[model samples]
Target: MPKNSDITPLPASGPQNKPASAASVAMPADSHSEGGAPTSEIELPDFNDVELNNLISGVKLYLQEHNFTEFSESNLFLMLIHALRTAINTSNDLAVQNICKILINLNEIDHAGFMSLLSKKIDIAPYTGQSFAFTLVDQFYSATITRDTPSLISLNFLFSILLQSDSLFLKQLAELQASGNSEGMFGLLLIAQALLRSSTESLHIMSSELIASLVILILKKNEELINTRLFQPIPHAAFSGQSVLTFLLNVVKCEAQHSNEFNNLLLKQLIEAIHNAPESLVNEGLVRVIKRGPDEGLNAGHIFLQALIASVQIKNNKGVADLQVLLKTLSARAGFNAMLLDNITSGKYMNQSGMSMLVQALMAAKDNEYDLTPIMDVFAQIIAEQGKEKVLSALQQRVKYSSTTYLQLLTNVAKDDSSMTRLLNLLENESSHQETLNPAVNGFFSKTKSEKEAPEEEHKEFTSTHSSSASH
Candidate 1:
């Protein structure tokens, strides 16, 4: 048993957000086939009612008595693990639900105690008899939406515990789901969600490879039960001031850079889910994806951005009447839209494609107020990688869309002494000997060329249209 000194109560306040409700958000009513299979011929094993009831009663009694310290005893823990194992071996839903209820009750009654037990370094090899770890995980999944605790905090804590489970536990969860066991898929998601709650820098190091494997298993088995259940709650939780977006950002980032094709498939399914999903989820999912892999969902990102920007447009399309589209616009107006512009300019996502997306997004942004530092950083990186000339030529076309942007960029460069010196040196060297202008330097003339080369009739036609539009 843990000594009394080691059993301190966890600080009562967590996340400080409202508790997540199981029934608070409504999902699409259709029940997808278990394992998302084309036919329901597959029969998964049912639960053992007697064993499950005993396990639940034991766990609940332990929680109620504040006797988790007893679990610290090697022999007691082994017995508990055995019971949990037997409970999962059964295919009975009520038995599974009862076990879940015990876990949820433990969380509500003694969160600190639960976290303490999870943090204990038990020798998991001997404990792996029937994947007791998976059963414990299933307990968490069953309680996720049903438990009453601070919004993402309790969920985040649950995720942390799952991530620390033995690899065998994770492996078993993956195997069960792969074998078309719908219930086992729940355990996989619990692990996935926990990984999402870890720090971004630490996340890639801790769970990238493992998460890749799990995501692959989910996709290969086409486990819609897990996806529909877990993913559906994200937006609702996020919209109600939860940080599901932040969590997803970590998860998506880990998935994005993996070389595995499974990661790619997961990314694809994730995007489709975003398109048809509710507004809050779409926004949360998009933000996370963009934060991690801005280039992954090119078309979806474009549509999402357009949808976000469209909301801010003075003249919106009457045909697009979805509340999500409307909310995206309103969110844009309230500075939520600024996140796109901010990410683009943040330099955190600097790459050829990232810069390309930034330019495209900026063009779409029109007169939207956004910082240019990220773009400037991107410009510097592009010039360094692709050379100055290519970057300048590209900028030249973009500058015509906004002289204000051009001046701001030039002003930013001039203000930085090192960058200014380089600019002066480049200009001087080119001006000294070149008969033809360098591409980078020629950005100043790009717009001029279009104006000078325009045919008289076409120019007049363009001017007339501008004048007419201006008059209106």
Candidate 2:
């Protein structure tokens, strides 16, 4: 060290700085004086030849004591890039993670450029070199999408990096879709997750076109899977591609349940997609969504109901199972049945095809006693809303069930002279065959509970067998 030479700044190998407000641990360097000025900061001292030699000698001693070997000057310059390459190639996940942490500190390693470089490395990696953008998606999926896993740190870095270039990521997804490779679908799902997790920050990217493309790719891919007839009949254990489907469903649910309007739109698209899917798959997705409970207060169950109702609008023969799902969904929600009936009365739904579907569902589940009170409530509302005659007429034509069913309901809710006469006639006709139905005639025609309670003590003990028999 005869004379001072130029000093290259140290490579950015420490934690990258964020806004001080975001840092969890503040430093003494960050301390402000009482006047809101930074305190006298410790600055790096410039070195002269003698000082540099002395520092070098001290560092040499430290390295020797620490048993560290130093590489040559040029070798050190290229060591990190070479090491990162080796780690990725050899699948040394730990080394790659640690190296990524180091690279993030380099000021020259801007997010977009670093991610593009990293993608090249991933493309050369044997396991994750898929046509899609997320290089390690296959491995991440193989690890079962768990939070605690080996590739987690690497994948998280990749996702954060990818989130910065949303347009490019979406364009890659489109390419993946066009190629129709299964690995591409896997990548597509992972990219969608990244995009969803990203907020509207500087690094985050979410445009309408990007969102639509992602949704279209997902729906198309899921449709292709269902078309294979693997998951038909819904929720079969024999379904071959569990991971892919699980990933896609999670993506849909995450987007759908977001507070954003765009997210809600995604929910609508998913429902419509499921509706148009194979009937068995539609049923399966609906049942599974219903079981999992709501997310964002707008769970899959609600979307399932929307899909079921929308399906009747389609120009096709809806199978009995689909109709049953529709009916079951309606019955689960309060006041939905009345709405359905209103739609029917107003000629807004249940065409000949739809009515047949519904009738089949009702017949299949006539005796299902899950909620008798709700069922009765529907009938009561139907009678009060559409009138007894329209309700009975619609039921007789649409529901091919027992006249006794309609008659019993009418009697329970019916009143007034004209309505009572109509009920009396229907009751007499249904009972003419030998009183196969007595609850209606006995409960209504005999007397009501109010009549019995009116003069109980004054009239008598009121020990009427009729009241006891009717109740029982």
Candidate 3:
């Protein structure tokens, strides 16, 4: 083994020559005394070597001594250079293990120079090369600015390195994902941040590949990390530059069925990113990243509707209105109204607790003054298209759609002082008018139960009639 010039008497790997504590070695080189070796006589490994364990403590001490100033950079780099070389020269299990231990221990320190050196030396095969590469990337990420500009630039070099190593990096990332190794996947995200940094135009040029890679990450790998706060900044970064945002928007607009949780989270984040995103991202080309699963088929339209509903629930008035318009565009483009009618009439979401969530969002959207007329128009159009039978079927499936609630809702609609008058008017139209709108309404009002002793069937019939009438 090579000597570490800066420090003499480095600790060696494997078992110690003597017991390091009062505990006896279970199997000794020779038969031991029945009781054990004398406690005082048992020698331990050198205290400093054993306590510091590896290069991590030394690197940390150096940073501490320098008050963590830029002047310490060169000295740290020198130490890391030697360590990287030593590990490379040894190139065996012990060396790899030692290097990993050191890197893990140094996780908290700002040691970009060391990370860069390690990244360069990590190309060696049969040594868990990808894990080491990602470790270096992770350290680089840790070194980045959490709240300032200068650090972002300093860390941008790491992005350059990641961009250069994309394929190898992605392959290793996939392996880590398959192995269910979250730490390794976290490192991959440090690399992914680079892709989000590309110019809007550049992203546009490579939108297909970018989206494909994002989908794979969200759907096929590292789900736990995909849902984390760390993943939140990516969409904003991806939309920072105009050219890239436009390109991304166009790509998303063109792709209709991105069905993955990661993509879902990304879509949610993209909606958030719109607040500060370049106009190109919000307006350029087509921008519906929220999509349906394969199982949804025609039923997939509800997914976007749910997303729209969620968007409207935002507390900010401007945001709610903006989203309402955005949703209108999306619904018109994707024909979501028909799907919603199908799900509601089929009672597909009747038992799903998220139905309540939808109601809550709708109530929230109701508070916004953005002429909900268009939204109501879409709702009416859907009913018109699906026929009253489907609409009534959907309402019957929803336990919340009782005759009492519809009556009260009608009363409230008649009393509202807001801009939802048109929707309210539609709902208050007479039973006969509703019949012209949908056959379900016609069938519904045709039956009547006794005043005080209405049969269960009669109650359902009465409720359906009121619900249909309320929508007229």
What would the per-residue lDDT of candidate 3 be over residues 1-472, giving only the tens digit for each residue?
1111111112223224443321111112222222221122222232233332344345444444443223222223323423443333333223334444444444325344333333322222222223345544443333221221232333333333433432444343333311222323434454344333332123332332443354334323323333232222223222222222222222222222233233334444444444333333333322222222221121223333444444443344333444355455544532344445333322334332222223333444555333456566555665566554444444433334443323223224323444444543444344456645444434333343232123334334543342221110
- Per-residue CA lDDT of candidate 1, range 1-472, in tens? 2432121111112111233221211112222222121122211222245433544454455544445444332222333433444443433435544544555554455555544444332222322212334546544333332331222233334334433542332333443322222322335545555544332234333233444444444433434333343333223211222232233333543433233343344445444444445566444433443222323322223333333233222223221223233333323321233333332332233322223333433322232333333333434444445544444433332222233333223323333345444543443343344345554454443245344343334323332232111110
Ranking by lDDT: 1, 3, 2
Backbone clash pairs for candidate 1 read: 46-90, 46-91, 46-92, 47-90, 47-91, 47-92, 48-90, 159-194, 311-329, 345-374
Candidate-wise lDDT, in order? 0.36, 0.34, 0.35
Candidate 3 minimal-lDDT segment of 10 residues = 1-10
Better of 1 and 2 by lDDT: 1
Candidate 3, which segments miss by more than 4 Å at Cα?
A: 1-176, 180-316, 332-339, 342-360, 368-370, 384-388, 397-472
Best by TM-score: 3
TM-scores vs. true structure, each candidate: 0.33, 0.29, 0.37
lDDT of 2 at 440: 35
Where is model 1 more than 4 Å wrong at Cα? 1-49, 58-93, 100-114, 125-247, 250-351, 366-472
Report, for all candidates in order, the number of backbone clashes.
Answer: 10, 0, 8
lDDT (10s digit) by residue, model 2, range 1-472: 1111111112223112322121211122332223221122222233333333333333333333332112111112122333434444445566556544544443133444333333331212232234324344444333222222344456455444554444444344333322212433435455444443332111223332243344444444443543322223223233222322333344433332223454444444544554456655544433331122122222223333333232222233222233333344344433333333322221112222222222222222222212223233434544555445444333333222222233333333234234334534554454444334333333433556465334333212211111121110
**How big is the positional error of residue 420 in model 3, measured in Å on the Cα after superposition?**
4.9
